[model samples]
Target chain A: MSSLIRVRPTKIELIRLKRRRELARKVYRILRERLTILVNEFMTRIRRAYHIRKEINRDILDVYNEAAYLLGLYGGSIYEYYDSTAVENSKVVIGFENIMGVKSYTAMMKKGKFINTYPELNEFRERSIMLISRIIELGRIEQSIKTLGVEINKTKRRVNALEYIFIPRLTSTIKYLQMKFEEREREEKARLKRVKSMLEKHRG
Target chain B: MGVRDAYFEDLVTRVLTRELRIVNRHLPYKRVSLCDLEKMDIPYIVLRDGTAHLIDPRELEYLTNLLGKDKCKLLLPIIIEARQSLGEGTYIVRDRVAKRVIAEILGVEYEEEKPLIIYRPHLYKIREVLPTTTTIIFSPT
Candidate 1:
């Protein structure tokens, strides 16, 4: 008679496989929730960035046009026509204390001196242009921040997908495989037990 | 293969075998060397020479088509030429049919190799090999 050969999976392995599946599912749920939040934050930031950029551009243009009109009164050569003597009278200003939200007064000071000396109606043109430049710089900073926010959100989403969707699916498949392995093992063990009993009976 | 490589391999197998149905719906697995193909569901094939790999199936088509019918007739020779130019280590073949077709036309030998892990940064690095001619298609899933 041919000897009976049996293959069986241990009980421990079956338990481990079940635990793995449960863990994978849990991870997937967590990632999905996190991803949704990140995506929402990203969209909100992008919208805010767009609105800020538009407002900055419009404000810069408005300031620039006003300066141009003022310069038009002084022969348009605001830089060349500046009053050199007024340098003594003009204070070296550091901040835009007078102008609300307009910073970088050093540039404004230079333009102010130039316009005062020129005696042209358009004398303030240079200062206006300088103010516009500052606004543009502020807009750039805002844009960079917005861009960074978008990138961070995208990265978060990617991580979430891997954690929730891809990893979970893989773990589930692995769990299935492990369970199948365990079932096969148990069947083999039963077969071996049956063969052993038969052999004992024969020997007795 | 490192974890990343294995992950990509598994991903490719799933894609090719239609296991990962949500991603890259157009890519399909064809009759190809199993070892070279690695994972069954993924949409890529492992290059014998290794080095860089292609992940975009559209890129493979664009490259093969650029080689023309005469060059594409057998497949292997073109793949060998591409591989020689590609240089070093295992690379995934994103477009199996195009790769095989090119290889067959070129009359080059093909062999199967075991799957291996691909690690991080390496996964991102492989993206460089994709053909610039084709638009990149990212699968969010």
Candidate 2:
């Protein structure tokens, strides 16, 4: 049986349960503070991500259109050549940067070379790279925000468990044991009085 | 924290600082000053917020070859307005190829005779493609 329903506690047990409750309270306080800060940081990250996405959507269309128009004017043959070479073996440099103590990836695309035949094509190719890099940066920020959001929720769950479930049950058990101990003490006192009186009456 | 604790903390968190200092190439963007831009020809001028494309004197002359000299403004650092001159979040581009490129991307109207007025979306495209070539200026609210 659980301690809440059927437990008889001696003074030692009561003291132990009281200590456990105190520790739970202390942990809850700390987690609650962390949760508040996490939520605020998450909000700021989401807002920045939202703006960046909007910027990307708004600008990306025109750039694509321009690329299409420019490519069409030149020839379709160039697209495949440029596409194969523009991003060959390119690695994105990813690292964590802490914003208000939460870490997020800061990404930068490292390109190989600008080895295209046509000068006009180079212009379009370079533009494509820039647009893609912006997308990468925005994606990293967004993913970090999501990670923080999940952590925040987990923290909240722990806080709730401590407050509503574990702490309350422990407290009730402690109260129940204290009441039982007082009742036992009173009973012992009455029995001692009765025994002493019987001895007095016999002596009379 | 104790001195020893602070020293260990430094060891754990030191990589983050190094990454920030070294690899922030395209994160916030590196800005270029106007004084430095005028001494020699450059493709772009960077403002605090966004990069702006520069109109070098030679490039302006090339623009003059196409649009004729009277339209060419013989000055560096042209101001691209958003609200008053163009629409909201726009920069008026003068080059024919660049204008056509922007127009094609944004699906916005353009005129061969007049300077093309670009909105936020189009400006975003230009900034993405030619980040160094263009700068962003917000309309006063």
Candidate 3:
């Protein structure tokens, strides 16, 4: 009775509470399922982001070494020279990618054309480009993980509320309504019986 | 109950209904073919929410190589239906080609006679390989 929601002790209210309880259960089940999937998605992205970060760390070191070596070999003007030889600047097409209702920015690189420079420099350029692509991928995953985390938290709250609060209250209220109706019926029967006895006594 | 309480009661169900309605808003209104997407400069599909969901060319190329001449049969943004009745952690992919593609990607065996049923781990693996190209829909049934 303490958990019962405040509602009129009528059949209509009982029916409504029952319906609400059913809806809450359905929603709870679905939301719980969704929360599981969202958590799984979060873990998957986290794993991927970790692996990508590892690869980027290793690749970045190698690229850095190459850059230092090239700098020593070709002097400071080498970067300027490389930029001047580029026929087309490197481009990345950034757009949104939605995954299971989670949206995040994704990027695709459009390789740039450049005049053939020193072979070593060309190798460095390719490595750097690959590194940039991996970084972009990392960014995309990181953003998605954040979004999924927020969604998971929100869903968990709703599921918890339905499970522990709303559904229980509705159930108790429904039970209260049923009990009230039964009590009224029993009282009515007893009163009718008392009146019948009184009429028999008067007639006698 | 007071009118205010009744209104509050409806509020709970209303919020749930709204959430369910928006769950699949990211899904495409009509899925496009992989070949058609390849022909476009910036490959993308229009979602039910009226936003463009971009597709990766690399994934398209990989699927193209896998399906070969049947690439056109493969649709953009593969749909994975998640049903509560299927029990927790299980999903179904109904399209024959999508089933084959997912099965091939996940290295799982499936029969053409039945829809492809995959578990959570399989889904994670598939999504890892084809993140942008795959979407999951929550089926109320």
Candidate 4:
């Protein structure tokens, strides 16, 4: 409960504390490295998501305009035609992607079978599928970023605790024990001197 | 020592041991080549932790194009060794083909048949392009 480790000022305790400190330092080094990698991974995903989102935003208007023009030309039947061309519905393969130890759900778009009848519809379908795949990728990156952020925070806390609180506490306790042993040695030397002087005075 | 100190020491040892054991657990049991991975319905490597670490087909294709005929020689899930003795923010890529591929991808030049030493920014760039196909191994020297 106290700031110092409650251990007797013995050589064995000192050895144990030293070993513990070494282990703590090793763990700290490793955790710090992990934190660095995780943060890097997080930043990478953030940048990727930003770029994908930007690309989608820039292209969405054009795609929408194309859709609107098609609607105006062919009316609502255009939607029916596009829908009817599908031999099967589009599929998304969803799975977990583990970046380091942080797991995030990733979805990859699987292109579906289509009749490939109308050129205009085909162009629109291609463009739409591209946009949709980008969106799915963006979603995956965003989720990964979120998960990485949480992991980074957790790792950072452990690193900080080890750096500031735990390692230092162990260090100070070790120092405290060392100093206590030295002081005891000094006191014993002084007492021996006094006792020898007294014995000499009696002999004199 | 008091029981509390003993308990704390035991706990610290346990935690550190666990971390050390699991640090590289995400690594693949056996790395598959790019050519082989491309042949699978779902390209993935079984991790030491018993989980399937998926490899993106896009990444595989990109590497294939980058390496050309040498794609078969290129291993899956490129291992980036982060050694503490290598100093901070520096990683080593020991695989000759992987080094060449990563160097090409990152637009960095490296001597032939030598280990590629990359900095933090380079690592970020590599991970960005090959998020699923690259894994980092932390080595506490």
> TM-scores across all candidates?
0.35, 0.49, 0.92, 0.92
True contacts kept of each: 0.00, 0.00, 0.71, 0.63
Instruction: Give lDDT tens digits, candidate 4, residues A1-204.
Output: 466767778989889889888888988998998998898777777777889999999989988998998999889999988989899878888887888977778888878899987787788899999999999999988988888888889889889988987789889989998899999999999999999999999999
lDDT per prediction? Answer: 0.39, 0.56, 0.87, 0.87
Q: Write the per-residue lDDT of candidate 3 for residues A14-50, one digit (tens) a residue.
A: 7877887877787888788778878888998999999
- Give the runs in model 1 whose Cα sits over 4 Å from its true position: A1-48, A82-157, A160-165, B1-141
Whichever of 1 and 3 has more lDDT, that candidate is: 3
Ranking, DockQ, top scorer first: 3, 4, 2, 1
After TM-score superposition, what is the CA distance of residue B77 in candidate 3 from its true location, in Å?
A: 1.0
What is the C-alpha lDDT profile of model 4 across B1-141, one tens digit per residue? 768868877897788778788878888889998889999977888888777777788898888888989989988889999998878889999998999988898888998878899998888888888989999998878
Query: Which regions in candidate 2 have their CA more than 4 angstroms from the true location?
Result: A1-5, A77-89, A93-108, A111-126, B1-141
Per-residue lDDT, model 2, residue A93, is: 63
Candidate 4 Cα outliers beyond 4 Å, as residue runs: A87-89, A195-204
Which candidate would rank higher by lDDT, 1 or 2?
Answer: 2
Per residue, candidate 3 scores C-alpha lDDT tens digits across B25-136 of 8899999999899999889998888778888888998999999888999887899999988988899999989998998898889999899999988888888789889988
Q: Please state the Cα-based DockQ of model 2 relative to the true two-chain complex.
A: 0.02
Clashing residue pairs for model 4: none
Ten consecutive residues with minimal summed lDDT in candidate 4 chain B? Answer: B47-56
RMSD of each: 20.4, 18.1, 2.1, 2.1
- Tens digit per residue, CA lDDT, model 2, A1-204: 354734446787677667667656655554554465467667766777888898889879878887788768877866777767654555676555433234445555666565666766777767767778779868876877877887778778877877887678878988999999999999999999999999999999
Better of 2 and 3 by lDDT: 3
